[model samples]
Target: MNVLLVKDDCGRSRKTCHMPTHTAIIALTKGGKQLAQRLKTLVPGSEIIPNKGKIHQTFAQAWQDHDSLICIMATGIVVRSIAPLLQDKTVDPALVVCDEQGRFAVSLLSGHLGGGNALAQKVADVLGGQAVITTASDVLGHTALDLWCRDMGLAVTDKQGLTRVMAKLVNTGSVTLYSEYPLPPLPQDIIPSRTLDAADLLVTSRIRQKENIVLLHPKALVAGIGCNRNTPAKEISEALDHACRTHQLARESVRNLASIDLKSDEPGLLAFAHAQNLPLDFYSPDQLNQVEGVAASAAVLRATGAKAVAEPAAILSSGGGPLLVQKMKFPNVTVAIAEILQPFPTLF
Candidate 1:
């Protein structure tokens, strides 16, 4: 994780610059020079970035570029400088603030979602100071949903639902948690319920349009693709979307896209996979044909020496699972989907 250190005053902070080498320090000149020297002594390999322009602009850029920001400046100054750029918790970087003396590290924003609270503790440890974390979930010992989702690699489907449920949970302790996936040891606030009909928060890989239900999609599905030569990338993408839509599958759960080795060099297929940010796995015709239970097509068998393209590819990619979608032939592409089978028990 990249960290950016911004200090407005340099002279006094020079000795305190003994931060870790991975940290990038933005030193405001004049008063910042001495602080930079001090920091350099403390942190041997950490590089210092000269404050080139407006402080707010630097803060904004650092927020985008780094995973965390350690502001060795006044909390008020850091707050105002970063206020304009403050956005959603899901994407914002962890923000930690320390006094000019580097005493009392404070987690000012994104305590859980961006790991600000954790960073505050680390910074406080480095400075021989105290970490002040004010997030209610952390202070009260309740579950931080955003942090949990991030750690589990689950994507939030209904962020508004999450906020609404969180308000109810924090204010009235009225939220039920249910999951179709494996359960982790949860806080008392997130009580398990048996049914989605009674849940405020739902965790699954399926698409749901119900109001006030925050869906946490686990990465579980693999998609297989078979396209004719010269097929446009858009067609391949659209076909996959259609397949997912038909099955009410959350497209976010797609782990990767699999195709035959013959299509490995197919520009359109490769481009589509890259654009979708889905890893593409290409299997040999022998490997594809080895899989059973796929509907055979004469044209596909003759062309690629495989019984089917999409079905076998999907099954193989998922490491042998029941096909969630059989080979679906579109005008330019054939698509299939399969859920990766796991030993997740349904109940206690």
Candidate 2:
């Protein structure tokens, strides 16, 4: 998808990826299979995987492909089947276990970051059961740090620090939050801090890291490129890295890329976008010229129809958002960065 959209209070569309969209529902017993069939219909992009008696083989085959797995079987069966396939929680798929009677849905693994808790709750709603969430934050009725970051489309920069912060938050029952952008009313446990130094959790695109501080980088930045013909992907990558590093911005915060339509067929640019798995938006000269506050370049105008490529393209692609970094030149490439305003969802 080019840009994932979430509706704001005024119904304005904003870019956001809430959670895993693909799910695999697996069942071993006849009664369990019936429950899985019902779930497959209610869950979007979910498929029922009939157990062929080899539970390990079935799990191994579907482990890498699916974002989440719902096993309609005993919790012990699921725990044993997926134990060997468990990896880092960040990349591990969410696992939910449901009883054959459909009386309880348990978030078995990756409760927060991998969205296992949310999936369990959803499954419970569909089956008219109780969702068993054991995560400390959920049990205590406090803000779930990892879930909040995931819902906001923010990447955790420091995994170790996040764990520490989460432990402390659960113990102390509160955390101070600092953000570059304005946030909506927060949970009772999350108090907004005016300064970054006083906060335990930070929401920003800037690359800030410290001991015991959890940095959440939102995917809200767009990069615009102006490159010479046949500019290698390495050169473009280096230019982007240099710009972000020099400006203290996190590369993980970049949402997509933008460029003039004249370079739509450029192989190097296409390769770079594909490698990064980022959507590249191309605009015509007329569209670029309509954007204001872009630096004009006579050379760019002569080469392409647009007076400016990097600056105007960034501005237009960001929906007229303010520029964070004006055109910065490199050996064979130029880059400009813009911030797309992200709306904060209701946190309470």
lDDT of 1 by residue, 1-348 (tens): 121222223111000112222444555545545554565456534445556888888887777666677676777788789888878887777777766565687998788887789878976776677999987767766677777776776788678877777767777665797888677566678889888888888878789787767888877788988999999999998999999999999899887788887886788886776676667767778878888778888999899988788888888777787788887889989999988765132322
Q: TM-score for each prediction?
A: 0.81, 0.84
Best by lDDT: 2
Poorly placed runs, candidate 2 (over 4 Å): 1-20, 230-232, 290-295, 319-322, 340-348
- Residue-level error in angstroms, candidate 2, position 208: 3.0
Lowest summed lDDT window (length 10), candidate 2: 10-19
Per-residue lDDT of 262 in model 2: 78
Query: In candidate 1, how many Å is residue 192 off?
Result: 2.0
Over 1-348, each residue of candidate 2 has an lDDT whose tens digit, in order, gives 243434445232233323346899999888988888888889889998766868999999889878899998888888888889998888899999999888999998888888899899998998899999999989988888888777777888788888888888899988898888767677788889988789998888888756567888887799999999999998999999999999999999998888887787788887788778777777778878878778899999888989999998888777788899999999899999998776353432
State the C-alpha lDDT per candidate. 0.74, 0.84
| Per-residue lDDT value at 295 in model 2 | 88
